[model samples]
Target: MQILIAGASGFLGRRLVSHLRDAGHDVTPLVRRPPRPGEVRWDPTSGVLDATVVAAADAVINLAGAGVADKRWTSQYKQVLLDSRVDTTRTIARAIAAAPDKPRVLLNSSAVGYYGDTGDHAVDETAPAGEGFLADVCKVWEAATGPAEDAGTRVVLLRTGFPLDKDGGLLKPLYLQFRLFAGGPMGSGRQYLPWISLPDWLDAVGFLLERDVSGPVNLTGPEPVTNAEFSAALGRVLHRPSLLPVPGFALRAAVGEFGGEALASQRVLPGVLVREGFTFAHQTVEEALQQAVSSITQ
Candidate 1:
């Protein structure tokens, strides 16, 4: 199968590309700069994508978006977040719609933030949209796939949680801190932090790519843990002591509204994946951390 991916240079996209190639799929990266071998350049910001580019893909995966945690969320950066996701998605959706031979699947990215603070409740894909900055962004971000869906494309929204990659995702900094014996819970330590091991996430994506699945799929682990639980698990994996906790006020002051994301509770579950018979290799936080540690060591 031919897979066209936007944001292929990003953390998750980079790994997905390698995994897809290993699985014998032809992976074509859509970039903004000069095209590399087997690559095509498209400018989402300028809204300049060739129709031929979109028509060639058996599947289209749009992972292009501003990093939610890249910088402090100022009023301007908030708009940047919205445009980066909604605009990029719109660009690809339009291409898929206009293409003569439309792709069979359009897997657009979203986040568990769509459910906002779910407290202790484990909300599934059927739950209603939540509130706040990240939630609002997710609402618009997922909605941008309307064009492709209307054009008879099978659109799948990947409402992902925190991806646990040793090199990049959420584990890198935490790994460093654990080595220094400074690892600790943030805010109240009661908030849920939905997470998935990178390898497991990659496998899940592969399972969905070929299967007849559509609509929103929560790309998270089967088991959700609290911030305190996550901190303790990482510490145990690294043989460190998680004795400190960052206050909610301090966090809010440091990163603005983005801090609210860390402090807010969201115990999300992969309801769709389980019902579809998707198998997960890393089912718990401890198992996921073990693989992450091995990845770092090697």
Candidate 2:
């Protein structure tokens, strides 16, 4: 398979490129810089991409976006978050639509924030859009894939959860905090945290590439855990004590607008993945945390 991916330099994108290439798939990355061998150049901010490039690929996976937690969500940075995702997705969708021969599928990125703060309730793909800044961003982000989907291209909206790995995602800072014996749950710790192991996330993307499925797919683990449970599991895995609990106000003070979201409850389930018979190697939060920790030491 020939796969063209936007945001190929990101944490997940970099790993995905290696994973696909290891599986013997031809992967071409979309870059903002000058083109290198086996790479495509496109300015997504300006919606500049050759339709021929879209036509040449068997599949296109877009993971492009400004990092939500990268900086304080000022009104300016908030717009950056929206534009980065919506503009990039719209660019690819338009290119795919304009192509004489469209790619077989478009796997665009989204987030579980589409469900807002679900509290104790569990949600699947069928859930309606939620309210809030992140929710609004996700709605527009997913809708940006309209052109490709309307053009009869199979479009998959990857409503990803928190991916657990030693190198990145929400785990990095927490790992450091635990190492310094200052780690604990955030806020009430009762809020559900939808998380998936890095390996399962990679495998699920590969699975969807071949499966005859479309629309919103939640890339979360089968069993969602509360923030407290997750913190405890991480502490156990690292042989550290999980006694401290950060209040919501402190979190908000620490990370600004992203803190509210950091404590947001989302009991998201991988309904599509499970219904389609996708298997997870790590079913529990503890298991996932152990694997993540061991991966670092090994």
On residues 93-205, what C-alpha lDDT tens digit does candidate 1 reach at each position? Answer: 99988999999999999999999899999899999999999999999999999999999999999999998988897888889988998889998899899999888899988
Give the lDDT of residue 200 in candidate 1. 85
For residues 205-273, what per-residue lDDT tens digits would candidate 2 score against the true structure? 999999999999999999999999999999999999999999999989988989998888999999999
Off by more than 4 A, model 2: none
**TM-score per candidate, in order?**
0.98, 0.99
Candidate closest to the true structure, highest TM-score: 2
Displacement of the residue 93 alpha carbon in candidate 1, Å:
0.5
Off by over 4 Å in 1: none
